[model samples]
Target chain A: MSVILPGDDLGISTDQIETSIGPGIYKVPGIKDTKLIPINGGLLNIQRNKQGTRQAAHLESNSRRYIPQVSDMVIGTIVGVYAEYYKVLLQNFLSNVTLSVMAFPNATKKNRPNLRQGQCVYARVSSYIPDLETELECFDLSTGKDGGFGLLDESGYIFDVELNYARELLFNPGFLVLEKLSTKCMFEIAIGINGKIWLKCGDGVPIPGKSTDEDSDKMDVDYVKDLKTTLAAANYIKQCQKVSPEQFDKVLAASFKGL
Target chain B: MSSLEVHAGVLGNSDGSCLYVVNGNKVITSVVGPIEAKARQELPQTVSLEVVVRPVTGLSNSREKLLEEKIRNLLQNIIIGFKYPRQTIQVVVQFLIADGRPEYTALELNMAINSAFYALVDAGVAMYKSFVSTVVAVPPEQGSSLIFDPSMEQIVASKSHHVVTYSVEHDECKIILLESNGLFEMKELKNILDAAKIQCLTVHEDVQRDVIESKLQQDYIWKS
Candidate 1:
C-alpha cells in the first residue's frame, strides 16, 4: 500500500516523493488519490490497514473558542434572574450560562433555590434551551456522582481597571486596597476590565471562609477595620505587580493608593 | 459576543484539567484526584470539591474566595461527592488574562470547566454529564447597546452590566451561576441572555472541532 503524505502546500508535488515501495525495498509510495503526504522521515512503511486511513492532515490550526456543552461542569456567578431562569455570567459575553428549572429535576417550581444578583452557584449542563436566543440547561445532576453548591452574600472589593492594567495584574497578581475606618475598614478596589476596587476591612480580622457569611450585613465593622491594612497591602502589591519590577521600585515611591 | 478557545490536559498530573480563553483572556483549570481524605476529614461517603481561583495579577480578595465557593457549589452538585467518600477533587483555575472584563475571564473559567470535565475523564473519573458556560453582559444606560460578552473596556465604559452563566444538561437549559453589579433591569437582562446563547453555540462548535482534531492528531502520531 502507498502512503499519501500531507503537506502544507496547496498541492503535493510528484517530485517530492523521491522514494518508492516495492516487493523488496522499504521505501513506501507517498501518494494517495493523486495527493501526497510530505515525507519528513526516511524509509516510509507502506502497509495498508483493513480500514482505509482517513486523510486528515489538512486540519486547520486549533481555535481557542469557548463553548458550553450538555453535561459539562462549569463555574459562574449570579448576575440576575429572568422570568424562568437566572441570568448568570459564564465568563464573558463570549458566552452566557443559564440554569433553568427545566434543567433541575429535583427543583420544584416554588422550592427552587433563590438565585439572587451577586450570588454565586454551580449547576450542571442539563440541556440547551433552544430558541433564536439559546441557553444551556444546568440542573441535571444525573451525569456525575456529586452535587455542589455556590457561595452566597459574600462581599469583596470591586475595582475599575484598565485593560492593560487588568492583564498585567492578572499575569502578575497583587492585592486590593484597604482603608482604615473607625467603624468599618473600607476597601477601594478597582477590578481590571472596568476596573473599580472598593472594599471594607473590619477591625483587625482574619479573612472569613466561604461559609461564614450568609448575609452581607453579617460583616461587622471591626472585621472591616482589621482587614484594612491587609487589603491595602494586597492592593498595593497587585498594582505594583502590574508594573515591571524596575518600574515598581520607582512607582512605589510615589504611589498614592496605598496612602 | 466574543469567542473562547478551551484546551483540556494543558497541564500535567492533574486529575481534571483545562485551558480556556475568551478572546484574549485566558484561564487554566486542573482537577486533582479524589484521593484519600485527611485523617480528621469526616466526609467518608462522598468526595470533596476544592476550587482555587488564581487571579491574573492581584491577591484573591474576598471576592475571589467567594468565586471559589461559587465554583465549589456547582462542582459539588455535579461531582457525586458521596460516590467517592473521603476523597478530594482539587480544581485549580489560573487566570492568565482578564482584559478588564470579569465576564470574559469568567466565561473562560466556564469553558475551563468543560475542559476540566474531559481532563477528569482523562484521569479516569466518571461523571453523569458534561457542561458548558456562557456570559451575557448588558450596559446600564437606558438606550445604550446590549453587549453579549463585552470586553473590559466596554463593561467599564457602560454605567453597569450584568453577567450570567448558564448551562445545558439532560436536554434542559439550567441556570448554573450568575454575578453582576447591583443596578440592572429586566429589559437589559433578557437581551444579554438572548445574545449570550448565540455566543455559547459558537464556542461549542469550536470546542467540538478542536476535540475531533486533537483525536485525529493523536491517532496520526500514535500510529506512527
Candidate 2:
C-alpha cells in the first residue's frame, strides 16, 4: 500500500452505501452520499467485510498522544484515587479518565476493589463525551462479566511504545513478535493501544514478603532471573518497533545479552 | 539554486517536530495538538490552534507576533479542526539562523510556513490540504524576470518582494495568501503568483513528498 499524505484524494472512492470510517479520516457530514478525505499523513487502509456489503477505512499513523476512544482497551496508571472513582492517566500531558469503583464486576460500596496511585489497570473505554471526563470500566457490559479487564499484575513492568506498534502487537494475530519473545522466556503481557504495555515474566519482580529463610534463599535466585528476563523482554519488544521482522531475532539476542 | 534540508520527528517529547533549513534560514517547529485544552483555549466545535514563533535572537516582539498571527491564519484555512473538537493543537516555531535582511521578512515567513507544514504532517494533525510558500522578488532592472526564492543579495537589489502561499490538493495549487511590499505592478504581481504556483507545486512534490515517504518507510518498516 502506498503512503497517503494529507489532502491526497484516496483513489478508492467511497461508492458503497455503508462504509465505516476510522481514525485519520475526515467525513463530510450532512451530505447525501459519503465523501471521505484524509486529514493525516499515513497508510490508507480499506477492507471490505466478509459479506462484501460493508467496508471499513482508516488511516494508520504513528502518533504519541492517545485520544480516548470508546471500546479501546488501554493500560492506564491510577493517578487519582477518590471515594467513588479513580482517575487514570493513559499518557502524560493529556486529560485524565475516570474508572468508577462500581464499574468493576462484583464491586459493591463496601467491597470495592482497592486501587492506589502508581498502580495500573487494564480497562476498556466505556463512554466518551466531548469536553467531559472520559469513563472507563473493567467489565464487559455486554456480557456482564470480567473480560480480563481489571488491575494488572502489580509486579509487572510497564513501558511505552509508539501507538501504532502497540496496536499491531495486540490486534494482529499473525504478528509473531510476542511468539518470538515467548520462545526466550515465559511472559504474560497486556498490550494497550494507548502505547502502554504491562509485561510480566515468570513470577514477576521479586517482592520481599514474609518467608522462611531457607525458602527465601532458593526463591531469590529464581526471582532475580525473572526480573532480568522481564527487562530484556521489554527491551526486545520495544526494539521490534524500530526494526523489521527479520531483525527481531538479532534485537532479541542483543537485549538478552548476559542475562 | 538554494539548498533545503528537512528532518522530521527530531524532538523526542513532542507529538511531531521538524527542523527545516532553506539556504541559510533554519527553523525548528513542533506541532502538538488535538490534546487537552485549557479553558480559554477550548473551542466549541473545532480544535484550537496555538502558534508561537520565536525569533533567532532576543526576546519575542511584534515581529514574532506578526509571524505567529500569519501562521495561525494560514493553518486555520488548511487544518480540518472539527475532527478534534474542544481540543487545541499547539505549533511552536523557533528560528535558529536567518540570512535575509532584518527589514525584509519575506524569507522568514516563507521558511516558517514550509517548516510548519512538515511539523504539522509529522504531528499527524488532520488537514484539508498540503501547502507551501515561496518568496518572489521583482528586480528593478527593466528586463529582469521575477526571482523565485530570492536571496539576501537579490532582495537588496529588488524593487519589490512578495510572499506567495498555495494550498495543494490533488496536484492542484490554489493561492492561499499573498503579502507584498514595495512598489510592484499588477502585471508583475500576476506573473509572480503564476510562477509561485509552479514553485509551490514543485516543493510539494520534490520536497514534501520525498521527506514524508522516507519517514513513512521507517514508520512502517515491518509492513515491507
Candidate 3:
C-alpha cells in the first residue's frame, strides 16, 4: 500500500489489465481514447487475485464522519422522548434518529420503557430514508432478542475514535487491545459503528500494590484511573498497525505502568 | 528565494488549517465547512464557498475583497461543490506577518492560494486536483530578463508582474488561474506563462513531498 495525493496517477490502461475503482478515486477523460486517468489523494491499494489486478484508493489519513445506513448498530443518546418517537442523537451524525416507542423490546401501548433525557442506548438502524429521517430498533433482526441492546446503566469510559478504527475494533477478531486486556483483566465493551466506544471494567476495585486503599473516595479515584488506562491502551492499539512489534511493548509499557 | 516552510494542521479549533512561510511572508489559513449555511448565503445546488482575506493591520479593504474573489472562483472550479449542497465552506486567510512591501502583493496572493489548498486538503475536502501558483516579475524594458519569485525590491523595479496557477494532470500542466498587472506584448506574456509553469511544478513537488512525509509520520504514530 502506498500513500497518494490528489493528483497522483495510479495507472493507465496499458499497465493495468483490468480496472476496479473504489472510493476516493475519480476518472478523468484523457486525450488517448482508450485510457482514463485515475487520480485522487489518499491511500492507493493494488490487489492481485485470480480474477485480475484491482486498484483502489481510500482516504486513510484522518477518520471521516460516519453516515448512517440501514442495519448499522449505533450508540446514541436520547435527546427527547415524544409520545410516539424518541429523538436519539447518534455519535457522529449531525441528524438524529427517531426511535419509536414500540421499537423497544417487550413494549406495549402502556408498558413502554421509560427513557429519560441524556440516556444512552444501543440500537440498530432499521430504516434510513435519505433526506427524511432515520428509524431505529432496539431488537436484533436475527434472533428477535434484545442482543444486549438497551439503556446502558453502568458508569464507564466512553471514547470517540475514528469511524474506521471503531469498525476495526468491532469486527477484527485479532484486535490487539481486546486480546491483551482480556488476558489481564475482565471487561465489557460496546463499539458503535459511528465511532463511539463504551468500556466498563471492575467495580472500583484497586489493583493490588498499585495504589493505597486509605483514600475514602477510592472508588471514584479508581474509576478515573481505570478510565485513563483504558483510553491509553485503546490509543496504543489503534496505533499498533504503524508501530513495530519490538517497539510496541516498550512504548505501551512506558505509557501504562504494569502493562 | 528563501526555503519554503509549510506546516499543516496548525490551528487547533479549525476543521482544517495550515501555516505557510516564505521569504518573511507568513500566511495562516483555516477552513471550516460542509456545515449549515446562512439563509442569504446558501446555495440550492452547490456549497456556498466563502474566502476571507485579513491583512496584517486594520480591516479588510476592497483590495482584499478582490483577492478573495479570485481565490473563491479558483476554489469553486477545483472543489466538488455539488457533493455538499446547501452547506457552506468558509476559508479564512490571515497574514500573521506580511513582508511589508506593496509590490509583494502578488507574492502574498500566491502564498494565500497555496495555503488555502493545503488547508482544504487537511480538511478532507474533495478536490478535483490541487493547484500550485507562483509570481514572476518582468522588467519594463523590452529586452530585460524575467525574474522568478521576485523580492519586494525586484517587484518595485519591475514594470510588469504575473501570477499564474497551474494544475497538473497526466503529467501535463494546464493554467487554471492567471492574474497579471502592467503592460506586455502577447509574446512576452506567453514567455512569462511558460516560465511560471515551470516554477509552479517545483513548488507543487515541494508541497507534495512535504504532505506525503507528514502523512507518513502520522501513520507511523497512529497505525502500524
Candidate 4:
C-alpha cells in the first residue's frame, strides 16, 4: 500500500512534522518489526510488552533524513588529524565525528594513537552535539575482548576526501581504472568523498614513489602547476560547449601549457 | 584517487559556472551568455545548448572529443532549445580526477549541468524545461534483483557495470541512455529504468526545494 504523507509527499513532509504530526504517531524505517497496535486517531503506537520491550515498528518515509546515533555502526574515514584525535566523515551529515586517543583503553604516548586522513574505520557513533551540528565522538569499542581504542584489527586502509573529490571518484571511470592499474603495490589507496586520499600498507611501509619529505614537496608543486594549465583549457571547452573537432588542438594547447 | 574542493562563480561572464571532480580527478566549468549565434550555427527560431569537456592536464585527445559529443547529445535531448531564438548557451565541464569509472563520468556531467542551470536561474535566464538527471546502476554480483545508486566501492567490486541516464520531460521507457559493458535481459532494463525514474523524480523535487529555499533566503519570495 502506498502510504502518503500530507501533500502526497513520498515520505514525511517537513511541514507536516513541524505543524501536524502528533507525538504518538511516527514514521521510521523498520517500525513494522514491532507490530505496533493501533491507537486513537488512527495512530499506531507501541506499548511496552512482556517480551523485553517489543521492537519499535517503523515505516520509513521518503522525506526523513537519518541522523547518526550513538551505537549505530557506520563506515567512515579519517578526514582530519589532531594531536590525539581524528575527524571522521559519516555520509549524509555535514559534520565529522571525533575520536580521541584517550578514548582507547590501551592507547599510549609511544603507541600514540592518531587518525590518518583517508583511513577507514568501523566505528560506533558515540555522541551528537546538536547546536554545533557536530558528532562529538566515535570509537572502535566492541565487547569481543578486542584491544581498546588505539588501533583495532588492521584489515584495510581508508581515504579522506573532500566533497568534490568524492563526487569525482563516484562518477569517473578513469580513476577506477587507474587504481586497478596501481593495485600491484602493497598500499591500498582510500579516496575520501570530502577530498582526502589515504594510503595504508600491511607492511607499514609508506607507498613507494611518494616522499613524505622535502623532495616530495617539489614534485607536488610541479603536479599542481601542470594540473592548473590543463584545467584552464578544460574550463574553456566546457564554457564553449560546442567547439568544432578541428579546434580541439588549439584549446588543448592553450590549456595545457607544457604541451 | 583523492578528493578536492573546488568552486566557480562565473568565468568569462557566462550564464553560469561550476567546479567539479572527475573520480578523484579535478575540473572546473563556466557558462557563457545567451549571445547572438554564428550564421552557420544559428537556428531561425530556437536557442542552442552546447557542451564541452576539458582535460585537466593534457591535449583534447580522442577521448575528450568523444565525451564532448556524447554530453552534447544528452544535453540537447533535455534542453528546450527552441525557447530563445538566436541565442547560445554554452556548458563547460572539466575533468579533475580520471579514475576507473569511465561510464560514471556522465554522472559528473549531469551534476555540472545542474550547477550551471542553477546559475542560469540565478542570472534570470528563462527556460521551458528543468532537466532532472540520475545515475542508475545494476551490480554484477547482485544479478538483477537489486539496483543501486552505486558508490565507488560497489562499482569497483562489481564484475560488470551499467549506468543509465534519464530526462524527466521525456518521460518514456525507451528514452534512457544505457552505458554498460555487461549483459542483461530487457526485463532487467525495464526494472532499472523504473527505479531510475523514481530517483529522477526525487531529484526534481529536491532541485525545486533548493530553488525555493534560495529564493526564500534572499527574500525574493513574497510572504503571506
Candidate 5:
C-alpha cells in the first residue's frame, strides 16, 4: 500500500452516521464536521464495524517523540516523588506525567502506596487532556486490579526503540523477530507504546551483593558475561528491524559472537 | 531546476530532521515537538511554533528573523495546531550553504520553507496540507522569460523577484504565502504567481513524493 501524506484526499468520508476517528487524524477544528483529514504522514487504514453501522479510520505513523494518549501503556521512570502523585519521565526531554499514589491496586489515603524517586513503573495513561497534566494509573480500570501494571523489578534492562517498531513488536502477529530471538536465548520483555522496551535476558544485569563466598568472584564474572550478552541481545533486537527477516539468523550469530 | 535533492529523517537526536538542496541553496532543518510548552509561550488551545533560522557562519540577525516570521505565518495556517493544545512545536532551520549574497534572502527563505516541510512530515507532526515554495525572477529586459529558482546572479540581475508558496491538497494548489522584492508590474505579478504555482506542484509531485516514499520504505523495512 502506498503511504499517505498530509492533505491527501483520504477518499473516506465522515458522512457516516457514526464515525470514530483514531490517532493521526483529527477534525480540522473550527470547521464543519463534514471533513476528516489525516494530519500525520503514514499508511491510511479505514475499518468497518461488525454491523457496518460505524466506521473507523486512523493513520499508522512513526516518530521518536511519544504523545501521551488515553489508555496507552507506558514504562516510565519516577523522577520526583510527590505527596499525591509520582512524576515520571516516559521519554527524555518530554513532559513528565503523574502517577498518583492511590493509582495502585486498591489503595486509600491512609494506605497509600509508598513509591520513591528513581523507580521505574509500568502504568497506563488514565487521563490525557492536552490542557491539563497527564495522569497515569497502575491498575486496570475494568477490574480495579494490578493487571500487570506496577513498579518493575530492577533486574530488567530497558532500552528505547522507534514507536512504530514497538507497535509492530506488540501487535503484528506475523513478526518473528521475537520468536527467532527466543531460540538463541531466553528472555522476558515488556513493551510500552512510548517507544520503550524493558528486556531481561538470562539472569539480567548481575547483582554484585548476592554472593558472599569463594564462588562470589566466579559468579561476578558470570554476571558480567550475562551483562555483555544482554547488551548484545539488546543491540541485536534494536537493529534487526532494519534488515529483512531472512538474514536474522546470520545477524543474530554475528551479534552474539565474542560475548 | 538545479536538480532538487532531499534527505528526510536523517537526524537521530531530533524528532524529525531533513536536508534539502536545491538551486544552489542547501538547508538542514529539524523539528522537535508537540512537546511541552513553557509558561510564557503556552497557548490555551493552540500549539505555538518557535522557528529559529541560523545562517552559515555567524549569528542570525534581522535577516533570519524575518524569514522565521514569514515561515511561522505559513506554518501556523497549515499545521493543525488546535489538535495539540498547550504544546509547542519548535523548528530549527540552519542554512548550510547559500549561493546568494548575504544581503539577499529570497533563495534562503524558499529553501527554509521547503526543508521545514520535510522535517515536519518526518517528525509526524499533523499538517492540514503539504506546502511547497519557489522563487521566481523577472529579468530587467522586456519579454524575457521568468527564472524558476533563480541563482544569486539571476536574482541580482532581474528587476524583480518573488517567493511564492502553495499549499497542495487533494492534488490542487492554493497560494498561501507570497513574498516579493524589487519592482514588478501587476501583469508580471500575475505571471509570477502562475509560474510559481506550477513549479511548486512539480516539486511536490516529482521530488517530495519520492523522498517521502523512500522514507516510509526505510521506516517499514521489516515488513518486506
Candidate 6:
C-alpha cells in the first residue's frame, strides 16, 4: 500500500490487469491520456480479487456526514410527527428522512403506532434521491415482519462510532471483541450503517425460590447486582473500540479478570 | 528553510485538527462537518464552506474577514464539495502567535492556508489536490533582489510582496491561488512568482513526508 496525497497520480502503465477505481479515486485528463488521481489524502491499497486488481484510497479518519442510499438500514430518532409521515433524523445525515405511517407493520388510519417525538427507530431506506426527502420503511418486504425495525423502547444505551468501524462491526460479526464479550454476557445490539449503535443487556434478576420474609431484600440485592453487571458490560464494549483488533480478545479477557 | 512542527489530531472535540508551527509563528486549525447547513447558506449543487480566522490579539475585523475569504476561496478549489451537497464544511483557524509584521500579512495568510489544508486532510474531507503556499518579498528600488519566506525586517525593507499557492498534478506544479501587493515591474513580478512557486513545491514535499510518517506511525501501533 502506498500513501497518496490528493492529485498524486497512480502511474499504472499496463492495461493487462483490470483496473477498478474505488472511493476517493478520480479520473482526470492528463496531457497525453487520462490519469487516475486520488481526490483525498489517504493510503492507497491495491486489492486483487477474482475480478482483477482494483485500487482504492482509504482515509484514516471518517467523515462526519453519512450519505443515504437505497436499502441501507439506519437508526434514526423521530424528530416530528405529522398526519402522513414521521420525521426522523438519522445519525450522521444532515437531512431528515420521513417514515410513512403506512410503512409500519399492520399500520392503519386508526391502528397506527403512536410514535412520539424523541423516539428512536430502526428502519431501512426504501427510496432516496439526492437533495430530496428520503423515505424509510419499518417492515421488511421479504420477511413481512418488523425485522428489527420500528420504535425502540427506551431500554438501551445509544452511542456513536466511526462510520467505518460500524460497518466493520456489522460485516465482521465474529469480531474478537464482540465474540469475547458475548460469551460473558447476553446483549441485544443493533449496528447502524450511519455509525450509531444501540445496545441493551438482558435483565438478569434472580428469582427467589420460596416466599420468605427476606424475599424482598434478596430481590433488591439481585436487581442492583444485575444493573452493575449490565453497566459494566456496556462500558467494556465501549472501551473495546480503542483496542486494536489483534489485541482485542486479550484486553477483553484481562478486563474480565480484573472485574 | 524554516523548521516546521506539526501536531495532528490535537483537539479531542473537532472532527480533525492540527497545530502548525513554522519558525516562531504558530497557527491552530480545526475542521468540522459535512454538517447541517443553514437554509440561507445552503447550496443545492455543492457543500458550503465557511472559513473563520481569529487573530492573536483583538476581535476579528475587516482584515481578518478578507483573509478568511481568501482561504475559503482557495479551499473551495481543492475540496470536492459537490460530493457532499446540501452540507457545510467549517474551518476555524486561530493564530496563536503572529509574526508581528503588518506588511507580511501575506506570509501569515499563507501559513493559515497551509495549516487549514492539513486540518481538512486530517478530517478526511475529499479534495482534488493538496496545496502549499509561499510568500516572496521583492525590494521596491532593486527589482533584482528576491527573498523567499522573508523575516519581518526583510518584509519591511522590501517594497512589494507576493503570496503564491501551488498544487502538484501529474507531477506538474500548478498555481491555484495568487495574491500580490505593492508596485513591481512585470519582469520583477515574474521573477518573484517563479521563486515563490519553487518554495511552494519544497513545502509540498515536506508536508507529504509528514503525512507519510504519521501514517507509518499509525500502522506501527496497530501491528505492535
Best by DockQ: 5
Per-model TM-score on C-alpha atoms: 0.42, 0.95, 0.80, 0.39, 0.95, 0.84
Better of 1 and 3 by DockQ: 3
Candidate 5 per-residue lDDT over residues B1-224, each given as its tens digit:
56678999878899999999886578999999988889999899999999999999888888888889999999999988877898899999988988747678899999999999999999999899999999899999998888888789989998999989999998899999888899888988997898888888888888888888888888888775
Model 3 residue B87 distance off true place after TM-score fit, in angstroms: 2.8
lDDT of 3 by residue, A13-76 (tens): 4365655554556554345544333333456555556766654334455524455678888889
Tens-digit per-residue lDDT, A1-259, candidate 2 = 6678777888766665478889888877788766677888888889987888888889988878788789999999999999999999988877789999999998888889989999899999999876578999999888878888999987899999998888888898889888888888999999899999999998788656745365655667787899999999999998898998899889988999998
Over the stretch B67-138, how does candidate 6's per-residue lDDT look in tens digits?
Answer: 999888888888888777888989999999877555457867977888887788767787888788877888
Mind giving the per-residue lDDT tens digits that candidate 4 earns over A127-171?
643323334333345553332223322333333322323334445
Using Cα atoms, each model's DockQ against the true complex is 0.01, 0.67, 0.40, 0.01, 0.76, 0.49
CA lDDT of each candidate? Answer: 0.47, 0.87, 0.72, 0.45, 0.86, 0.75
Residue B145: error of model 4 in Å?
6.1
Off by over 4 Å in 4: A1-259, B1-12, B20-27, B98-116, B123-125, B143-147, B169-176, B219-224
Least well predicted 10-residue stretch by lDDT in candidate 5 chain A: A208-217
- Chain B, per-candidate TM-score: 0.78, 0.96, 0.92, 0.72, 0.96, 0.91
Q: Please give the RMSD of candidate 6 to the true structure.
A: 4.7
Docking class of 3: acceptable
Per candidate, native contacts kept equal: 0.00, 0.64, 0.21, 0.00, 0.73, 0.50
CAPRI docking class of candidate 4: incorrect
Reference A-B contact fraction recovered by candidate 3: 0.21
Cα deviation in Å at residue A91, candidate 2? 0.6
